[model samples]
Target chain A: MKARIRITLKNGVLDPQGKAIQNALGSLGFAGVSDVRQGKYIEIDLAATDEAAARAEVDRMCRELLANTVIEDYAFELAKP
Target chain B: MKTSVIVFPGTNRERDVADVLAAVTGSPAQIVWHGDSEVPQSDLIVLPGGFSFGDYLRCGAMAAHSPIMRDVVAKAKAGVPVLGICNGFQILCETGLLPGILQRNASLKFICKDVWLKVENTQTQYTRRYNQGEVARMICAHGDGNYFADPSTLDRLEGDGRVVFRYCDPKGNVTAEANANGAQRNIAGIADPTGRILGMMPHPENAAEPMLGSVDGRKLFESLLAA
Candidate 1:
């Protein structure tokens, strides 16, 4: 099975990198971009045969290592074997 | 007054901390490797500044799960005096020993300069040498030193007087302009609920010698000896 995770700063948390990117885009003539929030995407290949088991393992990884629950939120999806 | 400084793979400040500890305590400080499962018995445990594990996967996150941190966490919970400076502070937060997360500076730039810090609580063992509200000049060098916590946690930390240091002006005014990293409440340092563990972004060791520009940082080490 394969799993994909997305991590992002929680709402109300300041994203300075995202703001900087937005400014750069505006300067490059990319108008109509109201806001830009940066995040991380991670893909993992797992040996688990069951989709449910893979999802559970990935979720645990997110909580323990991949994402810092204090300032970021994480979600994952498991793909079929 | 023996002290132990944990040395992570990429940590470069252990010698600085050890030098200051020996100078102040009149005893040689031990350097404990991150892979060690046990920390030698000591009066103080210090996590000095520097990029641990190359600041990969967020600052201090990789080092927080190292073998030695398990022992450090246990000792901290048992009321041992644990001091985390700069990168060390980030590790403490990653290990859940401290309350908030350090975010990137608001200006989106790495800040390396001297800043004034107001001692908010002098009752803790770490701040005993300074009078309440006294100001200390220290050096801060970090790209992500902005501290953040939820509203409730911030309130509790303030209510319990756990905020040990706040970024301030030379005259001790905590104005927004004085905040170098956009930390919530201008908090530069904080102690655990028990007051035995402290995590601060400033580099006190760098300012301990007069030749280094300021000796204000020596008071913190002196306080440990007094305690």
Candidate 2:
């Protein structure tokens, strides 16, 4: 099984890196960019054969380590091979 | 007094903190590596500054889950005095020992300079040596030191007097211009609800020596020794 996770700063959280990218895009003549929010994408391969078990395991991984619930939100999908 | 300084990969400030601790406590601190499962008994447990785990996957994220942190977290919950400085502060937050997160600097730059921090709370073991409202000069060198927390949590910290340090001017004024990293409430440091755990972004260990430009931070060590 494989887990694909996406993590991002929670709403109302300031993201200076994302803001810098937006400003750079404007300077490069890319207009109408009102906002830019940065996030992370992670993939984890697992040997578990059970779909439900992989989902639960990956969910725990996200909550425990992959995402800090304090300022970031995370979501993930599991696919069985 | 005895201290234990946790050493993680990419941790560059262990010696700086250890030297200060020894100077104050009159005993050398035990250095514990990240892969170890237990931390030796000590009066104080310190997580010094540096780019732990190279600050990858967010600052302190990798270091927080190390084998030794399990014991560190257990010790902190047991009411041990835990001090996290700079990158160490980020680790405490990641470990859920402290609240809030350190975002990138508002200016999107690594700020390496001296800043004034007012001692907002002196009731803890960490700040007993300083008088209330006293401002001390410390160094902050990091790309991400902007502190953030939800409004309710911020209000609670303020209400309970857990905010130990705040960025301020030389005259002890906490104005927006004095906030170099745009931390919420200009909070440079905070203690846990129990006041046993303290996490701060400023490098007090670096400022402990006279040759480092300011000895204002020695008070923290003095406070600990007296506690």
Candidate 3:
């Protein structure tokens, strides 16, 4: 099974990379770009028995390594293809 | 004093810190590799500055998960004195061993220059060498040195006097220019509750040797020795 973990800066936290992208778009003739925020998308292969277990493990992984709970939020999903 | 400097692949200032440690402690500081799962027994642990793990994902993010960091964290929790320089400061935050994060400079540029810092609280083990309210010249080089934490956290830090250093002008005025990275509350350095672990954006090691420019940084190392 494969799972994807999405991590984002917590609400109200400044996102410099996202702001830079927004600025870049505005300069490239793209108009009315209200805002942009950059985040991470990580995919991992796992052998969990079910979706619930996979998600639980991914959450653990995020807390342990992928996401910094102090400043960032993370969620993961297990999907079969 | 037994001293050890952990050397991650991208750590550029391990030698500089080692030299300072040797000069001040009268004993050579061991250079520990990042791959090592255990930290050597030492009275002090120095996490020197560099773009650890190339600052991948986020500055200090990857290195925080490095094998050596686990050992470092364990030792820190056990009351061993740990000092983190610029990049090391980032790692400390990422590891959740310290509060707050190092955000990018408000000016959106990497700053490399001498900076003046006011000794906020001299009671901590890290700043005991400096007179309370005295100012010292130090070097800061980082793109993401702006420190940010929630309001409550900031209040607790201030209330507890854990804030040990702040940016200041040569005249010792806390001004915007002296705040090289525009950190929240002008904070430059902080200590753990026990004051055993210190994370600061300024690189004292860089200024420890007079030939490098200023020897003002020696006071910090001296403080650690006295501790």
Question: Each prediction's Cα lDDT score?
Answer: 0.93, 0.93, 0.89
Name the runs in model 2 displaced over 4 angstroms: none
Candidate 2's iRMSD: 0.9
**In model 2, what are the clashing residue pairs, if there are any?**
none
lDDT, candidate 3, B14-38, per-residue tens:
9889999999999999999999999
Considering every candidate listed, which one attains the maximal DockQ?
Answer: 1
The weakest ten consecutive residues by lDDT in model 2 chain B span B218-227
Question: Could you give candidate 2's per-residue lDDT for residues A39-62 as a string of tens digits?
Answer: 999999999998888888888998
Ranking by TM-score: 1, 2, 3
Q: Write the per-residue lDDT of candidate 1 for residues B1-227, one digit (tens) a residue.
A: 87999999889889988999999999999999999999999889999999999998899999999999999999888878999999999999999999988998999999999999999999877889999999999999999899999999999999999999999999999999999999999999999987889999999999999999998999999998775
Top TM-score prediction, candidate number = 1
What's the TM-score of chain B for every model shown? 0.99, 0.99, 0.98
Query: What is the C-alpha DockQ of each candidate?
Result: 0.83, 0.82, 0.49
Model 1 / residue A38 / CA error / Å: 0.2
1 or 3, which is superior by TM-score?
1
Candidate 2 residue lDDT tens string, B1-227:
87999999999999999999989988999999999999999889999999999999889999999999999999998878999999999999999899888988999899999999999999899888999999999999988899999999999999999999999999999999999799999999999987889999999998999999999999998898775
